[model samples]
Target: DPRSRDENGLAPIVWKREKMIPYVPTPIVYGGYLFDWSDEGIVNCVDLKTGKDVWVKRLSEGGKYSGSLLCIDGKIYGVEEGGTVTVIEAGPEFKELGTADLGDASYSTPAVANGRLYLRTFSRLKCLPAKKS
Candidate 1:
């Protein structure tokens, strides 16, 4: 509800993804849902208004996480600390488009603007052309 805000003047956590312990990824909100994940790579999509999960899935082989999730157009992009980027469709059903290997540890989230992707690793920054639908 717009009428509610936390001490920092941000909206409260409308939905909490279950079993996301130790480390929680920064969630991306779009399409009336919030997408987040656990440090172990369990991704959850929940209703925007209610805290009900639409679906949940594990990505990658499971490891530590430092980067948050990103949403562009209608796809979700996530980077694991060990350095693989996972792309999935943002919708009621779960669908992974593809993944890109960073070849090293990455702690920053991918920046998406103007249909391009900017990914950063410990030593390099890469720019990828806009993905084709």
Candidate 2:
């Protein structure tokens, strides 16, 4: 178990696992699970209570992934360095929902606010219309 001592000198319990390479995106906690994307672009869903990986999926064949991840409405979004945005259903099975071309080089993370998605490339910013259908 990965435990850390708090400022009060009390131990804070943390779930532990081995051979996990932390990725750029912060782990997403929802419904008793911690979702993380490895530096190698592998998505792992771990049991929050046990720190055991429930499922793992690779987004691409060793693609250089640098962007952050976005999960909303039971879906996980991943953006790769090659300007590809992949939307996958969040679950034990990796189900690809769809993908879109970003059209340029991008390192900036995608942003979702007020149901709208904002993305930026090197010198251009694109606003995607968001309406629940």
Candidate 3:
């Protein structure tokens, strides 16, 4: 199993000239690109068919990022363990859109329903306005 940790530790499988490993969270595919993030605040975008990295970027103020990634209307959102949500544009190049502070630590992935965003933090659950597209 991917999560099993015992005699065998984590290892990176070679992909082209780079070492690649499965992300802790399921990656999302959009516009022929795959987007995923790591707990170390590193985000990567790879070509959906070639398994080749298009771009890799790290969020500022590095910290634990446990929340699963969310993609909506061409933007990808990654939540840090400290409750800060970072939004980035989904494409070949990396472009950080913005970030929001939920005011509490969050490990659960944010959800969307009926045009609103829902987030569960350590201390609270919040519903915020999400742009309709």
Q: How many residue pairs clash in each candidate?
A: 0, 0, 0
**RMSD of each candidate relative to the true structure:** 3.5, 3.2, 7.1
Candidate 1 to truth, TM:
0.80
Q: Give the C-alpha lDDT of model 1.
A: 0.81
**Cα lDDT of model 2 by residue, 1-133, tens digit:** 3466779888876656667766566667767777787767788888887788888888754465677777778887767776777777777666778878888877767888987888777778888865466
| Stretches of candidate 1 exceeding 4 Å from the true structure | 4-24
lDDT, candidate 1, 17-109, per-residue tens = 456543656787888987876777887888887878899888755666788888887988888898998888999898878887899899888
Relative to the true structure, candidate 3 reaches a TM of 0.81
For residue 88, model 1's alpha carbon misses the true position, in angstroms, by 0.9
Model 2 residue 83 lDDT score: 71
Give Cα-based local distance difference scores for all models: 0.81, 0.74, 0.80
The positional error of residue 26 in candidate 3, measured at the CA in angstroms, is: 1.9
Is candidate 1 or 2 superior in TM-score? 2
